[model samples]
Target: MPVAFRLPLQVFYEREARHPRQPFLVQPIGGGAVQTLTWGDVGHQARCAAHWLRARELPQGSHIALISKNCAHWIIADLAIWMAGHVSVPLYPNLTADSVTHVLQHSEAVLVFIGKLDDWPTMAPGVPAGVPTISLPLCPAGDFDYRWADLQGCSPIQDDPLPPASALATIIYTSGTTGLPKGVMHSFGALGFAATHGTELFGLGEGDRLLSYLPLCHVAERMFVEMASIYTGQTVYFAESLDTFLTDLRRARPTALFGVPRIWTKFQMGVYARIPGKRLDRLLRLPFIGKRVGHKVLAGLGLDALRIALSGAAPVPEALLRWYQRLGLDVLEVYGMTENCGYSHVCRPGQQKIGWIGLPCPGVEVRIDQAGEVQVRSGATMLGYFKDAQRTAEVLTEDGFLRTGDKGEQDADGRLRLTGRLKEIFKTSKGKYVAPAPIENRLAEHARIEQVCVVGDGLTAPMGLCVLSTVGQPEARHALQDSLERWLEQVNAALDKHERLRQLVVVKDTWAVENGFLTPTLKIKRNVIESTYGPQFQVWSERTEVILWQD
Candidate 1:
């Protein structure tokens, strides 16, 4: 059967009935207490939760929101909502009350499911009036109301006819780096198709395991972590936290893992932190020492067992991808967005190439528009943005192709190499177009360069604001600056006259979500960086050398 016609909750329940004792999910809550749930338990719990939702006297297809960290119950609530024929909306845990209010008001969600409730007070004001909320780990201390367990005691609902495959199943809000968050509506067919292709493309099966650490709200995690489990009946493990991510990976020994470029980059840094790149490369030049060291580093990262490690959600520096390749992990770069049900293109196992997002996935058609913007027609194209038809028309073409808003080209071998966002291209003072992503990707490819923002708006040539190399020692910082200058010279020589970087600013700190420089998925907010540092670039540009920020 085509996956687009399959209901995931139905299949998951069948797996539970077939193998009640088999582990479906393994999560460590805290203090040596583990939360283990088999498919049977999940099936039973979701049915009861479905029954409770049905009894709520709300209209069918009503919206229910989930706000939480990565946890097992977060997923359970999601499936339960779908079982009840409702739309599930997930919110990032780090969003402020104002932003949360906007989503709640925008979605008109009837109820909320909050997991790992730490700071509920800050989130309380965001809940729209008349909406009831249920907390997963901890119940709301005040009037917010309800606990996850409250619905568990309800009667288990026998399956009624499941919703039609074309019915709206989920509404994922885009992170909105460029504009206000739009509720991206996806049908069961769209999501299921992505899972089907993803499972087959990655060779996922019953034996495979996956660690879920990235925000479940994100389409990448939702597709790779959640839907992969449904398609292949693989065990899905939720990470306790970043500190426990490695331990969880080792414990699960995941065969399939998905991470953003920043995470992969950090893993590369961790490997090199113990063994300097020069010594390691020299050792790798030999036969036995190189093999031994490579195995050790991969094993330490718990990635030695990974068959398919994916990087997506933002452009990854080619250097990081190649570094992992040297260590024997075939890290494939994927290009996708929430609108496409989290998949559009992927690099197959043996066909990886750095600096390219790779070939289109099975069942997806990709073509470059005359303006160089990539367009896609696929089974997974979103139905439309919720209640925003005009906005939907803006992205979806009249001929059924979805405008990707990304400028890219297909290589001779059909691999899609993304250049930058069509909207993000800036015009320099010399009236030349500057594509920052390609430049940023190249500059960030340097071993000593961590994060970079290519800035040249209204300027003669683009200059870079870079997060300094994390591995540099106090004395090495100065020397690293010299090395970066030389690296830039090489990069500049390869660029067109207008594309060359005029100067570089070495930022002392890493751009992090906590610092408001990067989004939760680790994509740099170009507007924020440009606005924050644009004034300083002129002063620093006068000095031709790398301007190191001391404080």
Candidate 2:
């Protein structure tokens, strides 16, 4: 790792008060131009918003909600919420009205700031009646009690609350893949410590850059993009839309990049589209010219400047890791949950290990319980699930270890390999237990499969129900069947008796957040998958073909 980039929580105050004109946030504007907001600009706008809050005379720790996509105003509102001595509750912009109402009611929020949204009609009804609302400039629908622009003409706050380390910073709700999402509370100390620890691990600073695109409501993106920029003074770029993602990446050319497994897989697919895997494989194996070949490929993907590329939030395929390594990109896999501020473990660069999440972070303690569940304790561990005392008690042990629902094995070398979620391990009709994660990891490398869920709940053996990649259609299935069959055979040979997949059924429909198959953070909803495809499992498993077409 490079020299540790240290910037305390005072970094934000100092940047605004001392170096006011310093570049901070870069916002994408229409007509292809960009807008740069300086620290001074942010401080002023935040002060204005703080004044608005002060005028309202809300309770000292009253909950305020922020619903928006990633944008400059979103961060400003967060800062102002804290400055005004209120706790912020952020909701995913795409959340349904019922979920929105659940959070607003659960958190007891009195005021909300609405911002960029793909669908406002569904999100609007979620706000509880009598709650006041302010609109961020990014909001498309433009319906709100007050516009963020209204704050522009207001005077700056003469005095603001100076919160101590113990003050609550935010309550980030978990992207509910199973049950109702729980709000994970974080103190200012925990958030600051997480950001400082991140800088130590990644060496991010003023010279570095970040692209803000993922939902800001999620802790991973919030930590990496928003908090990191505050603590390290990194310039943050906002992606205009999904269409300009590659363009944004190319323009930012960030030195540090973090993506979930799906993003990395998408990048891999993009590369394969331009250069056939066999041809690219040959180019990398050449003598003396291999390095040049890699440089060109990475530059094409706008990853040439990346010194640190991380993949997490799910299991990454071994084949995908090897594929990137061949192209001179080492994508380290980090593992953590929202309850811990995502600071549990990360694979160190140059000490590469495939199929295992690396050593514990600087101050984090990790252990495997008798149930084989991964438990963690750290300064960054959340205070508790908001307004859910019983649920909090269920997860936290007497001594304070957070019982991560994930089941894993920690090696003597301190690397942890996740097996599956404790509740996700299903027993077959034969009374044999099967862990689907490992098998799914193997199948995820299939070029035609975007996501795969292995199910065997009441069957003799497990079968895969996969949502095809863009090219994973019925026509391509028959052609790719032989190759996939050979690969599945190899994977099955390596697995235990009950873990083997009998067949893979390809589905025609897509799985997305809009379709209710995915969480806001893009993690697949296993329960939804089971409900949608469980009925077809019998027919799929009964088929003689190793890879069967369902659509």
Each model's lDDT? 0.82, 0.85
Residues 320-402 of candidate 1: C-alpha lDDT, one tens digit per residue: 77677667677888888899987889999888777777899888888898899999988899999988999999999998889
The C-alpha TM-scores of every prediction are: 0.96, 0.96
Q: Which digits, one per residue and each the tens of the lDDT, describe model 2 over residues 88-163?
A: 8999988889989999999889999998778898778888889989998878775689888886667988664577
Report the Cα lDDT for residue 183, model 2: 92
Worst 10 residues of 1 by lDDT: 1-10
Lowest lDDT sum, 10 consecutive residues, model 2, at 1-10
Candidate with top lDDT is: 2
Q: How close is candidate 2 to the true structure, as a TM-score?
A: 0.96
